[model samples]
Target chain A: MSYEDEINQDILNSKKLPEKLEISVLRYFWQSNPLIGKKTDSIPRFLRKIDVLSNFSENELRILAKYLHLRKFQPGEVIFKQGELGVGFYLLYNGYADIIVENTEGTDEVKPSSKHILTLEKSDYFGELALLQEISIRNASAVSRQGCELLGLFKPDLEELINHYPVIAAKLLQSISLIVANRLFSLTREVQELKYKLSSYEKDQDASN
Target chain B: MPQISINTKRERFKLIFFISTLLLAFIGLAAMPRVSIPLLLGYVIFLIVYPAVPTLEKLGINRVGSIWIVFSALIFFSIYPFVKVVPTVTAEIENVQYFLPKIEKYVTKKYEELRIEVREKTSFEIGDKYFFQALDWIRKTSTNILLNIPKILASLLEWIFFIPLIIFFLLKDGKKFKRGILKLTPNSIFERFYFLSHQFNKKLGDYIFAKFVEASIVGITITSGLLILNVRFALLFGLIAAITNIIPYVGPVIGFIPGLLFSLAEYGPGTTLGAVIMLFVVANAIDIAIVFPILVSKVVDLHPLTVVVSVILGSQWLGMVGMIISIPFAAALKLIAQEVYKEIYQE
Candidate 1:
């Protein structure tokens, strides 16, 4: 297997965390948990390492963890499929998931692989477009390339969180803008490559004639 | 380049979309100030019905009874408070007269002292006529406001009496009301409207609940704190703070000014100064550090800058009531625009 494939497998095969630690790990995102006086020390550091919850205050990070449902996906588990009603934004807490976009021609334009598409590891996030717009389905599918730990934020919960915490909205906006910019840059590069390929093909045809 | 043209066209389209949304939002915001009694009643009634639906169902209340119970409760609770508070708050203006002579004397004394100090340092004359003229303008404005109370009260009572009946009818037929409106729309647009309606309801409901909870908590907290501090009029000041706290940023300041003035009046300047400083710090700290951040995180997610800007713009158009409705109204409009743009344009 390729090095990338090995990395994906390692993520999928990673051991589940201790049950006691699991709640704290989840607390890293949902800040509402401590309202009734549950305290955890380790969660904030863990959430800070994750890109999405990094901007949350120590208190807010705890609240965010309360709303998150952490789940494990084994290799090849379909996390979500294209055209599914968008509900939650996801984060790769551990392991790798492959993002696959299906084109109109029934072909998958894979970002990294023809079979599985792009593999993402820890700290990577997706499905943000779902949070912003209603009636819009997921544009792509995320299938676990290896065993993966993922965090999810359902639509209603996110809106509630945003309404309550303006700072979180600011952070999410920054993350979203970064994601959009990255996508635009990649698309520009692809277009440039396509143009280069078309020009070379034209030159080759002239020589052959 | 082909890419440049596509980018430019896309940019132009985005600009158009953004401008149209802003215009729609402004129109919606402007409508809020003029929401009239019936619509305001409808909004409050709609809110109570959602949470009460399950409870009412469990109690074997049908939709009509639920509507009656909700509307009746709203009238008893809301209108009763307004009736109780408006006359009392208006009567409290009579107390303003008791303080006015003291205030004028205080102002004159302060101005005389300042004038003496200024003359000792520099020859800048503040004319006596100019001071009296300014004082006269203040008295005129105050008297006008005082005189307008009865006229305002009459209109308010008329609106209040009609609101509950309107609320009852709306609650009785809300789902039907919604469906009937949608049925008027073209088939192609129904799905979008349906989605938009759901999104609006969800966001608006969440925002209102979060805000109500936050305001209640803040009010109780400040009231308890004031009681502990032995502040006079603790109940009234705390109540005002809690109600105005609904308006974001400016609410606490408005709450503090009256509290500070009373503190100054009761205690000498030094004690008043300390109390004012302490109140300002504690009240603002609790609001910004704890209440607002947590409340906002749960409800609308608008940027703080956006919230402040919206509040200022909203207040400019709608006055006090407009300011109260501004945040959620802005959020609801944004949700609608997002739903529309995505469903209509993208697809």
Candidate 2:
């Protein structure tokens, strides 16, 4: 028999309920769901680094795993185009992804080439800010460097989850607060350096004159 | 292929009508005088059983074992509290009953003096009819509630047996129940309803968890304050406040009644009056200034007036149960309304 026929036969044989089912039948039905991919569990390590699911309990994590959709990307396939509506977060399970930004080569010295601003490795996750905060298009495009597996958790699910689990919502808020605070600190440092550089440039100009 | 098909509007409207009809039937049953006791008992039983799923899951026990563990835990949680407090409180209640007539006499005398004063000052007539009418109304209401005692007892006994059994089956076959529900749906509306239900479940779970935490905080604070004041039945009174804290605007009023009665019984009217006033102010201050703003922020997006109006309307329609569920029900309605508006009217 062909593989499809064999699989169909297997399903028929398995149709009879087992003498004693161990898990919640719901878990069994979910486990059999075709939407959940073989490597869905692999994505959790990467997603754990994202603030959203970091502190979720095992049951909560499992619920999240079921909710997330698995999407695969071949090399050079854009995970998300830069200027599209962002709906979900992507977790890189097994391949490299590059975050590309379109900008002149230098801030002052303009050039034609756009930059690969950042490259992310395995266990890296992105697209969260857009999903979490309902921002417009992503700031950069993430292209898979090779064949990759990713789990996409949509925005609406997250909001619903947060509403149901206020603790999780509270934690998400806390995480956002931390991210904003970190950005503020970095911006402050960058501003101070820029001020110093501008003052030095003014001194050089005065000396030249 | 999408594992769960996204059904079209035709399929969804059918399911929506079906679910809405079922819910309306439940509400009707809940509102009926005869069936209200059983319906409440059944609902509470389901609630007790439902929480067992997680409690068992958390313990890393198998589903059957988890059900047993949860069953045992609930029995302990409920029975233990009553065991510790009920006897003492019952004895106190008996004492209060004996003194009730004397206290009423004193209150009437004081009221008579105030009535004479008011009669002299204003064009007000002091009539026993008004007082007797008020007393008669209270008696009637109390009797109505007491008449349901047998039904309530039957429900309690039924719950004692039925909760565990329902919980076991729920934990065991809940997935099947859900899947069966899903399978019955026409493919057209499956996806949207599935997604919406998922969204609703998550929101509900979070709302309950947050409310539990918030109520606990309020309960503990009130209890501690009452304990410090050496108030009678501090734990019980604290619990009353905490439960009342569930309802917005009206919770503090419910909390204050028991506190006032306890104060009156323990101390005379003059001395206890100060304590009663302080209890209301403090308990309410905590709820308003601290507990509410922190616990349930943005969960119910209705304006203050809207919330007040909804509560009153809900109370009128379904009494206390309506009051308990009104906010969340209103919130769900608001959510569905917004979604429908955006779907139908938005460009």
Best by DockQ: 2
**What tens digits encode model 2's per-residue C-alpha lDDT throughout B1-347?**
00111234554676677678658877787657455544444444444356555554545666677766766776788788668765665455445455545545655677788889989999698887888677667556655655665675566666567555655566567656765665554433343455565566555555665666777877888788778878766776777788887778878788778667657745766755686568668767876778667767645667787778878887887777667667766777777787678657743
Q: On residues A1-209, what C-alpha lDDT tens digit does candidate 1 reach at each position?
A: 95446556766889453334345644554666564343334445467786544556777677677545465555665676665566667777778878876553444564432233576887788887776775558787777765677776656556545654556656766766777678789999999999999999999999999
Query: How many residue pairs clash in model 1?
Result: 30
Off by over 4 Å in 2: A1-209, B1-68, B86-96, B120-125, B139-154, B233-236, B261-266, B269-272
TM-score of 1: 0.55
**lDDT (Cα, tens digit) per residue for candidate 1, span B132-211:** 89988876886787788788778777766666666666666665665455434332232344445667787777777777
The TM-score measured for candidate 2 stands at: 0.57
DockQ for all models: 0.02, 0.03
By TM-score, the best candidate is 2
The CA lDDT of each predicted structure is 0.67, 0.64
